[model samples]
Target: MDTETLSDHLVELAYGPKELYVDNTYRRILDSRYTEIVGFDFFCALDDAIETALIDWWLSDDAFWGEVKAFEHWQDEVEDGMAWELMDVWETWYGADGHVKIRKASEREKVSYDKAMKKLLCEHEKKKVSIEAEAVRIGL
Candidate 1:
Protein backbone atom coordinates (compact mmCIF):
# COMPACT_ATOMS: atom_id res chain seq x y z
CA MET A 1 0.00 0.00 0.00
CA ASP A 2 0.99 3.64 -0.47
CA THR A 3 2.34 5.74 2.42
CA GLU A 4 -0.73 7.97 2.43
CA THR A 5 -3.09 5.01 2.52
CA LEU A 6 -1.08 3.34 5.27
CA SER A 7 -0.97 6.55 7.29
CA ASP A 8 -4.70 6.99 6.91
CA HIS A 9 -5.31 3.45 8.08
CA LEU A 10 -3.01 3.96 11.05
CA VAL A 11 -4.86 7.15 12.02
CA GLU A 12 -8.13 5.33 11.83
CA LEU A 13 -6.69 2.50 13.93
CA ALA A 14 -5.51 5.05 16.48
CA TYR A 15 -9.15 5.59 17.35
CA GLY A 16 -9.91 1.89 17.59
CA PRO A 17 -8.57 -1.25 19.29
CA LYS A 18 -4.80 -1.77 19.44
CA GLU A 19 -4.98 -5.48 18.71
CA LEU A 20 -7.05 -4.81 15.64
CA TYR A 21 -4.49 -2.25 14.53
CA VAL A 22 -1.62 -4.68 14.93
CA ASP A 23 -3.47 -7.50 13.22
CA ASN A 24 -4.50 -5.38 10.31
CA THR A 25 -1.02 -3.97 9.81
CA TYR A 26 0.51 -7.41 10.02
CA ARG A 27 -1.82 -8.88 7.47
CA ARG A 28 -1.80 -5.93 5.08
CA ILE A 29 1.71 -4.50 5.36
CA LEU A 30 4.07 -7.06 6.84
CA ASP A 31 6.32 -8.21 4.01
CA SER A 32 10.02 -9.02 3.58
CA ARG A 33 11.04 -5.80 1.84
CA TYR A 34 9.02 -3.65 4.26
CA THR A 35 10.51 -5.43 7.26
CA GLU A 36 14.04 -5.09 5.87
CA ILE A 37 13.56 -1.37 5.24
CA VAL A 38 11.79 -0.62 8.51
CA GLY A 39 14.13 -2.85 10.58
CA PHE A 40 11.27 -4.12 12.69
CA ASP A 41 7.99 -6.04 12.45
CA PHE A 42 4.61 -4.52 11.71
CA PHE A 43 3.35 -4.66 15.29
CA CYS A 44 6.31 -2.74 16.69
CA ALA A 45 5.87 0.09 14.22
CA LEU A 46 2.14 0.27 14.76
CA ASP A 47 2.57 0.23 18.53
CA ASP A 48 5.11 3.05 18.45
CA ALA A 49 2.98 5.13 16.11
CA ILE A 50 -0.10 4.59 18.24
CA GLU A 51 1.80 5.47 21.40
CA THR A 52 3.16 8.66 19.86
CA ALA A 53 -0.26 9.67 18.67
CA LEU A 54 -1.79 8.93 22.07
CA ILE A 55 0.85 10.97 23.87
CA ASP A 56 0.31 13.92 21.53
CA TRP A 57 -3.44 13.67 21.98
CA TRP A 58 -3.10 13.50 25.73
CA LEU A 59 -0.78 16.50 25.93
CA SER A 60 -2.99 18.55 23.62
CA ASP A 61 -6.18 17.71 25.53
CA ASP A 62 -6.39 19.62 28.79
CA ALA A 63 -8.29 16.96 30.70
CA PHE A 64 -5.37 14.50 30.64
CA TRP A 65 -3.16 16.74 32.76
CA GLY A 66 -4.06 14.78 35.86
CA GLU A 67 -2.17 11.72 34.60
CA VAL A 68 0.72 13.78 33.29
CA LYS A 69 0.97 15.70 36.56
CA ALA A 70 0.99 12.46 38.50
CA PHE A 71 3.78 11.11 36.31
CA GLU A 72 5.86 14.24 36.89
CA HIS A 73 5.25 14.01 40.63
CA TRP A 74 6.41 10.40 40.60
CA GLN A 75 9.53 11.25 38.64
CA ASP A 76 10.39 13.98 41.15
CA GLU A 77 9.96 11.60 44.05
CA VAL A 78 12.14 8.98 42.41
CA GLU A 79 14.90 11.48 41.64
CA ASP A 80 14.90 12.75 45.22
CA GLY A 81 14.99 9.22 46.58
CA MET A 82 17.92 8.27 44.33
CA ALA A 83 19.90 11.33 45.43
CA TRP A 84 19.29 10.52 49.04
CA GLU A 85 20.27 6.92 48.54
CA LEU A 86 23.51 7.87 46.77
CA MET A 87 24.46 10.26 49.54
CA ASP A 88 23.62 7.73 52.21
CA VAL A 89 25.80 5.11 50.50
CA TRP A 90 28.68 7.53 50.02
CA GLU A 91 28.62 8.51 53.70
CA THR A 92 28.37 4.93 54.91
CA TRP A 93 31.08 3.49 52.67
CA TYR A 94 33.85 6.13 52.91
CA GLY A 95 33.50 8.94 55.42
CA ALA A 96 35.95 11.72 54.51
CA ASP A 97 37.74 10.48 51.41
CA GLY A 98 34.47 9.78 49.62
CA HIS A 99 33.17 13.30 50.24
CA VAL A 100 35.25 14.90 47.50
CA LYS A 101 34.70 11.97 45.17
CA ILE A 102 30.97 12.05 45.81
CA ARG A 103 30.81 15.80 45.23
CA LYS A 104 32.66 15.53 41.93
CA ALA A 105 30.60 12.60 40.79
CA SER A 106 27.36 14.29 41.77
CA GLU A 107 28.35 17.46 39.96
CA ARG A 108 29.19 15.55 36.81
CA GLU A 109 26.01 13.53 37.02
CA LYS A 110 23.92 16.66 37.60
CA VAL A 111 25.28 18.32 34.49
CA SER A 112 24.81 15.20 32.36
CA TYR A 113 21.36 14.53 33.80
CA ASP A 114 20.21 18.08 33.18
CA LYS A 115 21.40 17.92 29.60
CA ALA A 116 19.73 14.56 29.03
CA MET A 117 16.44 15.74 30.53
CA LYS A 118 16.49 18.90 28.45
CA LYS A 119 17.21 16.92 25.32
CA LEU A 120 14.44 14.44 26.10
CA LEU A 121 11.88 17.20 26.60
CA CYS A 122 12.95 18.92 23.42
CA GLU A 123 12.73 15.69 21.45
CA HIS A 124 9.30 14.96 22.87
CA GLU A 125 8.07 18.41 21.86
CA LYS A 126 9.48 17.95 18.40
CA LYS A 127 7.87 14.54 18.08
CA LYS A 128 4.53 15.96 19.15
CA VAL A 129 4.74 18.62 16.47
CA SER A 130 5.79 16.09 13.85
CA ILE A 131 2.93 13.79 14.68
CA GLU A 132 0.46 16.64 14.60
CA ALA A 133 1.82 17.82 11.26
CA GLU A 134 1.70 14.35 9.77
CA ALA A 135 -1.89 13.91 10.86
CA VAL A 136 -2.83 17.27 9.38
CA ARG A 137 -0.87 16.58 6.20
CA ILE A 138 -2.75 13.36 5.69
CA GLY A 139 -6.02 15.14 6.49
CA LEU A 140 -6.80 12.66 9.25
Candidate 2:
Protein backbone atom coordinates (compact mmCIF):
# COMPACT_ATOMS: atom_id res chain seq x y z
CA MET A 1 0.00 0.00 0.00
CA ASP A 2 1.00 3.59 -0.53
CA THR A 3 2.38 5.57 2.42
CA GLU A 4 -0.68 7.82 2.74
CA THR A 5 -3.10 4.91 2.61
CA LEU A 6 -1.09 2.92 5.10
CA SER A 7 -0.85 5.96 7.37
CA ASP A 8 -4.63 6.42 7.27
CA HIS A 9 -5.17 2.81 8.28
CA LEU A 10 -2.64 3.22 11.09
CA VAL A 11 -4.32 6.39 12.33
CA GLU A 12 -7.66 4.58 12.40
CA LEU A 13 -6.08 1.81 14.43
CA ALA A 14 -4.52 4.34 16.79
CA TYR A 15 -7.88 6.02 17.51
CA GLY A 16 -9.04 2.91 19.41
CA PRO A 17 -9.82 0.08 17.03
CA LYS A 18 -12.65 -2.43 17.43
CA GLU A 19 -10.01 -5.17 17.50
CA LEU A 20 -6.21 -5.56 17.78
CA TYR A 21 -5.80 -4.67 14.12
CA VAL A 22 -2.36 -3.21 14.63
CA ASP A 23 -1.07 -6.46 16.11
CA ASN A 24 -2.59 -8.44 13.25
CA THR A 25 -1.17 -6.00 10.74
CA TYR A 26 2.24 -6.21 12.40
CA ARG A 27 2.35 -9.98 12.00
CA ARG A 28 1.16 -9.76 8.42
CA ILE A 29 3.62 -7.02 7.52
CA LEU A 30 6.54 -8.92 9.02
CA ASP A 31 5.49 -12.18 7.38
CA SER A 32 5.21 -10.53 3.96
CA ARG A 33 8.67 -8.98 4.08
CA TYR A 34 11.58 -10.88 2.54
CA THR A 35 14.35 -12.32 4.73
CA GLU A 36 16.95 -9.78 3.67
CA ILE A 37 18.69 -6.67 4.96
CA VAL A 38 16.65 -4.35 2.77
CA GLY A 39 13.41 -5.99 3.83
CA PHE A 40 14.47 -5.81 7.49
CA ASP A 41 15.29 -2.11 7.16
CA PHE A 42 11.96 -1.42 5.48
CA PHE A 43 10.12 -3.27 8.22
CA CYS A 44 11.97 -1.34 10.94
CA ALA A 45 11.28 1.98 9.24
CA LEU A 46 7.59 1.17 8.87
CA ASP A 47 7.37 0.01 12.46
CA ASP A 48 9.00 3.21 13.70
CA ALA A 49 6.69 5.29 11.53
CA ILE A 50 3.63 3.50 12.89
CA GLU A 51 4.77 3.84 16.51
CA THR A 52 5.70 7.52 16.11
CA ALA A 53 2.37 8.27 14.47
CA LEU A 54 0.43 6.45 17.17
CA ILE A 55 2.28 8.26 19.97
CA ASP A 56 1.74 11.60 18.29
CA TRP A 57 -1.94 10.89 17.79
CA TRP A 58 -2.46 9.76 21.37
CA LEU A 59 -0.61 12.77 22.77
CA SER A 60 -2.49 15.32 20.70
CA ASP A 61 -5.83 16.71 21.85
CA ASP A 62 -7.12 16.13 18.32
CA ALA A 63 -5.16 13.84 16.03
CA PHE A 64 -6.93 14.42 12.75
CA TRP A 65 -4.98 13.34 9.63
CA GLY A 66 -2.22 11.80 11.85
CA GLU A 67 -0.08 14.94 11.60
CA VAL A 68 2.08 16.31 14.44
CA LYS A 69 1.31 19.89 13.48
CA ALA A 70 -0.97 20.39 16.47
CA PHE A 71 2.05 20.28 18.77
CA GLU A 72 4.23 22.59 16.67
CA HIS A 73 3.31 25.90 18.21
CA TRP A 74 5.64 28.93 18.14
CA GLN A 75 6.30 28.70 21.87
CA ASP A 76 6.58 24.91 22.11
CA GLU A 77 7.47 22.07 19.78
CA VAL A 78 7.32 18.42 20.74
CA GLU A 79 10.37 16.89 19.17
CA ASP A 80 10.95 13.15 18.95
CA GLY A 81 13.16 12.94 22.04
CA MET A 82 10.73 15.10 24.02
CA ALA A 83 7.85 12.95 22.87
CA TRP A 84 9.66 9.83 24.07
CA GLU A 85 10.41 11.51 27.41
CA LEU A 86 6.77 12.50 27.80
CA MET A 87 5.71 8.94 27.11
CA ASP A 88 8.21 7.71 29.67
CA VAL A 89 6.91 10.18 32.25
CA TRP A 90 3.34 9.11 31.56
CA GLU A 91 4.22 5.47 31.93
CA THR A 92 6.11 6.15 35.13
CA TRP A 93 3.70 8.53 36.89
CA TYR A 94 0.61 6.77 35.62
CA GLY A 95 0.38 3.03 35.55
CA ALA A 96 -1.01 0.92 32.72
CA ASP A 97 -4.60 1.47 33.90
CA GLY A 98 -4.09 5.20 34.33
CA HIS A 99 -6.69 6.08 31.72
CA VAL A 100 -9.47 4.41 33.71
CA LYS A 101 -9.23 7.09 36.39
CA ILE A 102 -7.02 10.06 35.94
CA ARG A 103 -5.33 11.01 39.18
CA LYS A 104 -2.98 13.91 39.67
CA ALA A 105 0.26 13.24 41.48
CA SER A 106 0.75 14.81 44.90
CA GLU A 107 3.27 17.58 45.42
CA ARG A 108 5.52 15.24 47.39
CA GLU A 109 5.45 12.74 44.55
CA LYS A 110 6.35 15.41 42.06
CA VAL A 111 9.19 16.61 44.23
CA SER A 112 10.49 13.06 44.68
CA TYR A 113 10.37 12.38 40.96
CA ASP A 114 12.10 15.63 40.18
CA LYS A 115 14.85 14.91 42.67
CA ALA A 116 15.38 11.39 41.34
CA MET A 117 15.54 12.58 37.76
CA LYS A 118 17.91 15.36 38.69
CA LYS A 119 20.22 13.00 40.55
CA LEU A 120 20.17 10.45 37.75
CA LEU A 121 20.84 13.08 35.10
CA CYS A 122 23.65 14.56 37.15
CA GLU A 123 25.23 11.14 37.59
CA HIS A 124 24.96 10.53 33.87
CA GLU A 125 26.53 13.86 33.04
CA LYS A 126 29.32 13.58 35.59
CA LYS A 127 30.29 10.02 34.72
CA LYS A 128 29.66 10.36 31.00
CA VAL A 129 27.35 7.38 31.20
CA SER A 130 25.51 6.34 28.06
CA ILE A 131 21.76 6.85 27.97
CA GLU A 132 21.24 3.11 27.68
CA ALA A 133 23.20 2.67 30.91
CA GLU A 134 21.19 5.36 32.65
CA ALA A 135 17.95 3.88 31.42
CA VAL A 136 19.04 0.50 32.76
CA ARG A 137 20.00 2.06 36.08
CA ILE A 138 16.52 3.62 36.40
CA GLY A 139 14.81 0.36 35.34
CA LEU A 140 13.38 1.94 32.24
Candidate 3:
Protein backbone atom coordinates (compact mmCIF):
# COMPACT_ATOMS: atom_id res chain seq x y z
CA MET A 1 0.00 0.00 0.00
CA ASP A 2 0.99 3.62 -0.44
CA THR A 3 2.57 5.49 2.47
CA GLU A 4 -0.34 7.85 3.01
CA THR A 5 -2.91 5.08 2.96
CA LEU A 6 -0.83 3.08 5.43
CA SER A 7 -0.56 6.08 7.71
CA ASP A 8 -4.30 6.67 7.60
CA HIS A 9 -5.01 3.06 8.39
CA LEU A 10 -2.65 3.15 11.32
CA VAL A 11 -4.25 6.31 12.64
CA GLU A 12 -7.75 4.89 12.35
CA LEU A 13 -6.69 1.81 14.24
CA ALA A 14 -5.02 3.83 16.92
CA TYR A 15 -7.89 6.25 17.44
CA GLY A 16 -10.80 3.91 16.86
CA PRO A 17 -13.49 3.34 19.46
CA LYS A 18 -12.92 0.51 21.89
CA GLU A 19 -15.38 -2.02 23.20
CA LEU A 20 -16.17 -1.90 26.88
CA TYR A 21 -18.68 -3.68 29.08
CA VAL A 22 -20.67 -1.94 31.75
CA ASP A 23 -23.42 -3.72 33.69
CA ASN A 24 -23.07 -6.75 31.41
CA THR A 25 -23.74 -4.66 28.34
CA TYR A 26 -21.16 -3.87 25.67
CA ARG A 27 -20.55 -0.28 24.69
CA ARG A 28 -18.14 1.46 22.36
CA ILE A 29 -16.00 4.02 24.16
CA LEU A 30 -12.77 5.72 23.24
CA ASP A 31 -9.71 4.84 25.28
CA SER A 32 -8.70 7.67 27.60
CA ARG A 33 -6.17 6.52 30.15
CA TYR A 34 -2.99 7.69 28.41
CA THR A 35 -1.73 8.95 25.08
CA GLU A 36 -0.37 6.28 22.72
CA ILE A 37 2.19 8.54 20.87
CA VAL A 38 0.87 7.54 17.45
CA GLY A 39 -1.30 9.06 14.67
CA PHE A 40 -0.41 12.74 14.18
CA ASP A 41 -3.01 13.34 11.49
CA PHE A 42 -5.81 12.95 14.01
CA PHE A 43 -4.02 15.26 16.43
CA CYS A 44 -3.22 17.97 13.87
CA ALA A 45 -6.91 18.63 13.40
CA LEU A 46 -7.41 19.39 17.09
CA ASP A 47 -6.52 21.92 19.74
CA ASP A 48 -4.14 19.83 21.78
CA ALA A 49 -3.54 21.87 24.92
CA ILE A 50 -7.14 22.82 25.54
CA GLU A 51 -8.37 19.36 24.73
CA THR A 52 -5.88 17.85 27.12
CA ALA A 53 -6.83 20.24 29.88
CA LEU A 54 -10.52 19.43 29.59
CA ILE A 55 -9.83 15.70 29.45
CA ASP A 56 -7.66 15.98 32.51
CA TRP A 57 -10.39 17.79 34.38
CA TRP A 58 -13.21 15.50 33.33
CA LEU A 59 -11.35 12.19 33.63
CA SER A 60 -9.48 13.07 36.76
CA ASP A 61 -9.71 10.76 39.70
CA ASP A 62 -11.46 13.39 41.75
CA ALA A 63 -14.03 14.14 39.08
CA PHE A 64 -14.94 10.49 38.54
CA TRP A 65 -14.94 9.74 42.21
CA GLY A 66 -17.16 12.71 42.78
CA GLU A 67 -19.65 11.43 40.23
CA VAL A 68 -19.68 8.04 41.82
CA LYS A 69 -20.18 9.66 45.17
CA ALA A 70 -23.00 11.72 43.78
CA PHE A 71 -24.72 8.62 42.48
CA GLU A 72 -24.14 6.82 45.73
CA HIS A 73 -25.32 9.78 47.73
CA TRP A 74 -28.30 10.28 45.47
CA GLN A 75 -29.16 6.64 45.75
CA ASP A 76 -28.24 4.70 48.86
CA GLU A 77 -28.39 1.34 47.12
CA VAL A 78 -25.49 2.35 44.86
CA GLU A 79 -23.20 1.53 47.73
CA ASP A 80 -24.29 -2.07 47.51
CA GLY A 81 -24.14 -1.93 43.69
CA MET A 82 -27.59 -3.46 43.56
CA ALA A 83 -29.55 -1.08 41.40
CA TRP A 84 -28.06 -0.88 37.89
CA GLU A 85 -31.37 0.11 36.33
CA LEU A 86 -30.76 3.66 37.37
CA MET A 87 -27.66 3.61 35.17
CA ASP A 88 -29.61 2.16 32.25
CA VAL A 89 -31.82 5.19 32.48
CA TRP A 90 -28.85 7.55 32.44
CA GLU A 91 -30.75 10.52 31.08
CA THR A 92 -32.62 10.54 34.36
CA TRP A 93 -29.47 10.05 36.35
CA TYR A 94 -25.64 10.14 36.28
CA GLY A 95 -24.70 6.69 34.95
CA ALA A 96 -24.71 7.15 31.15
CA ASP A 97 -23.54 10.70 31.53
CA GLY A 98 -20.54 9.41 33.42
CA HIS A 99 -19.69 7.01 30.59
CA VAL A 100 -20.25 9.67 27.95
CA LYS A 101 -18.10 12.10 29.88
CA ILE A 102 -15.26 9.63 29.98
CA ARG A 103 -15.56 8.97 26.24
CA LYS A 104 -15.44 12.67 25.42
CA ALA A 105 -12.60 13.22 27.84
CA SER A 106 -10.65 10.44 26.19
CA GLU A 107 -11.16 11.92 22.73
CA ARG A 108 -10.02 15.32 23.95
CA GLU A 109 -7.05 13.75 25.66
CA LYS A 110 -6.02 12.15 22.37
CA VAL A 111 -6.19 15.52 20.68
CA SER A 112 -4.18 17.10 23.48
CA TYR A 113 -1.32 14.71 22.90
CA ASP A 114 -1.16 15.53 19.20
CA LYS A 115 1.84 17.82 19.31
CA ALA A 116 4.07 15.19 20.84
CA MET A 117 2.58 12.60 18.56
CA LYS A 118 3.44 14.69 15.52
CA LYS A 119 7.06 14.70 16.54
CA LEU A 120 7.01 10.94 17.00
CA LEU A 121 5.49 10.48 13.56
CA CYS A 122 8.07 12.73 12.03
CA GLU A 123 10.89 10.73 13.59
CA HIS A 124 9.36 7.50 12.35
CA GLU A 125 9.02 8.90 8.86
CA LYS A 126 12.61 10.08 8.93
CA LYS A 127 13.77 6.60 9.82
CA LYS A 128 11.68 5.07 7.05
CA VAL A 129 13.11 7.53 4.52
CA SER A 130 16.62 6.95 5.74
CA ILE A 131 16.26 3.21 5.40
CA GLU A 132 14.78 3.58 1.95
CA ALA A 133 17.61 5.86 0.90
CA GLU A 134 20.19 3.36 2.15
CA ALA A 135 18.49 0.56 0.26
CA VAL A 136 18.37 2.63 -2.92
CA ARG A 137 22.05 3.53 -2.54
CA ILE A 138 22.88 -0.14 -2.31
CA GLY A 139 20.84 -0.74 -5.50
CA LEU A 140 18.04 -2.62 -3.77
- Which candidate gets the maximum lDDT versus the true structure? 1
TM-score to native of every candidate shown: 0.30, 0.24, 0.24
Q: Give per-residue CA lDDT, model 1, range 1-140, as digits (tens).
A: 34696467556666654655544643444566664323235566667777676656743455555544555465566556656655555554343563465333466666666665566566556655665564454333
Query: In model 1, which regions exceed 4 Å deviation?
Result: 1-57, 97-140
lDDT of 2 at 10: 62
lDDT for every model? 0.55, 0.50, 0.43
**Candidate 2: C-alpha RMSD after superposition:** 19.5
| Candidate 3 CA-lDDT value | 0.43
Query: Mind sharing the TM-score for model 3?
Result: 0.24
Q: How accurate is candidate 1 locally (lDDT)?
A: 0.55
lDDT of 3 at 53: 44
Per-candidate RMSD vs. true structure?
Answer: 16.5, 19.5, 28.6
Q: Residues 1-140, candidate 2: write the lDDT tens digits.
A: 25796578567765553233444443433336563223345555666676666656443334332333322331143234444654566656653664577556778878876876676556545443453454344322
Q: lDDT winner between 1 and 2, please give it.
A: 1
lDDT of 3 at 25: 31
